[model samples]
Target: MKAPQGVTLVDHPLVQHKLTRLRDRNTSTKTFRELVREIATLLCYEVTRDLALTQREVETPLEVTTAPEIAGKKLVFASILRAGEGMLEGMLNLVPSARVAHVGLYRDPQTRAAVEYYFKVSESLAERQVIVIDPMLATGVSARAALERLKEAGARDLRFVCILAAPEGIEALRGDHPDVPIWCAGIDRGLDDHGYIVPGLGDAGDRLYGTR
Candidate 1:
């Protein structure tokens, strides 16, 4: 399926290969966690490709030269609760200095509506880029809620990153926040009756933590 506007598919060979393994039901929990970290790191690289840079003078043993450095305040990675935590470590591996924010939200099984339990983020969100990381974008309910909260808290620049997405979720997110770009490895056919991505890698949090 064609990706919706404002959405980017990170289909690099390395990412696809890892994703194939991640989808295998026989894969062990340890291996699943490793792949999530590896894929998240790669996805992070793509998401931040357009970050602004400024020139800085650097001195070498033999000579001095101007070098490019990331400009402005450090970026922020907002993890959307328990499942989002799976992507947090890998992203941090790439941007060690980035600030972190957490939005604790869960989907009610019956209604698939997002419920917030906790929320915390770094100050001055308006001055920094905020990327919300969650492994799965099934219903988009939780994601929308998280983004709304972040915006209410002063975030102006925001992006959403997920390992897998359903077309419905993409539409839902774009319907409300067209400006925020979505970066993902793949978009599956559609969601199941229970709001899970069809042919997805399964419950990412459960697979990562060996929990049901």
Candidate 2:
């Protein structure tokens, strides 16, 4: 599959294998949760490849040497509510010092529009490389809105990461915010009439939490 505008899909066999397990209806909740974290760790590795590094000098028992280390400025892991929270653990494992924020929005059943219900972002958003997480991108409304909030809070550098996406959502996000880079594990076909992606793993929150 072609990479989405600024988005990248890991597409490795390990990622694909874990995703396959995630899609299986018979997978136990504990296993599914474990797989999600593992996949997120893999994705986080790619996502942070460009993280700014600084040179440092280290002294060994025998000699002194120069090395590179991550800059003191930490990245921000922002999630779009309940489902997005599932991807946070893996990111945190890679970036143990990173801060977290949550944005909550639910689709209005009648109009199929995203409605903001809650939000909380780090006070240092402007100085951090903000990574927004969501498991699925169906319509792009929620992602767009969440980004708008982040921008309003003074975040400048931003990127979005998702487990899956649809053409409609990619187009919508690109049209709305061309500068924001997007990264996804895969891009499925399109959204169904009700705004869910066809052939999607189904409602991510429902599956993750066994809420259904």
Candidate 3:
């Protein structure tokens, strides 16, 4: 019914429709990629609703008018490595000028924990609102690790966006970063034994890249 604290389930009709295709086991790679991108754009709209705006006078052929524009520093779309990149194209479509950062963390099979290998972020993260994205929030190991890295790099304002999430993952993230909000198309049953989201679309990176 309701998502837990600091979690937002994006229930937009179009978002839900795309999410259905994403959850289909038989969905093709090309289609899955498209759906992920589309859903990211839709989620972006909702997560950015409260972004500060400033009014500026605009000149028109008929008359001058005031228009609202995004205020302050441009946003940073910090992608959590491979799968996170899948959601980038669509987010960029909405914020064409937003800077991008890539945070790479691979899961240790035995430990089932995140291990960072690469991290690169834009400067002045404290001044910008960073939106970290991944197709799914499964174990939240990567999401948690990614946000920790971003914060270390000075990202004070941040948001996490995903297509699907597990309740365990949401709680894990909330437990660590209570102030950072999360937005996802839906939350599935839960994480499976190996830390994968049950009924999830299965390894988003693989599906997006047709790797497995």
- Candidate lDDT (C-alpha), each: 0.95, 0.87, 0.92
Candidate 1: list runs displaced more than 4 Å: none
Kindly report which residue pairs in candidate 3 clash with one another: none
Q: Can you rank all candidates by lDDT, best first?
A: 1, 3, 2
Clashes of each: 0, 1, 0
Model 2 Cα RMSD, Å? 1.2
Which lDDT tens digits does candidate 3 get at residues 37-110? 99999999999999999999999999999999999989999999899889999999999999999999989999
Candidate 2, residues 1-212, lDDT tens digits: the string is: 68755778789999888888887888877787788788888888888888888999999899999989998688899989988888999899988999998999988889878899998988878889999999989999999999999999999999999888899999999889898888877888899988998787888888778787
Question: What TM-scores do the predictions have?
Answer: 0.99, 0.96, 0.98
Q: Which is better, 1 or 2, measured by lDDT?
A: 1
* Candidate 3 CA-lDDT value: 0.92
Residue 25 displacement in candidate 1 (angstroms): 0.5
The TM-score obtained by model 2 is: 0.96
Q: Can you tell me which runs of candidate 2 are displaced by over 4 Å? A: none
Worst 10 residues of 2 by lDDT: 1-10
Error of 1 at 207 (Å): 0.6
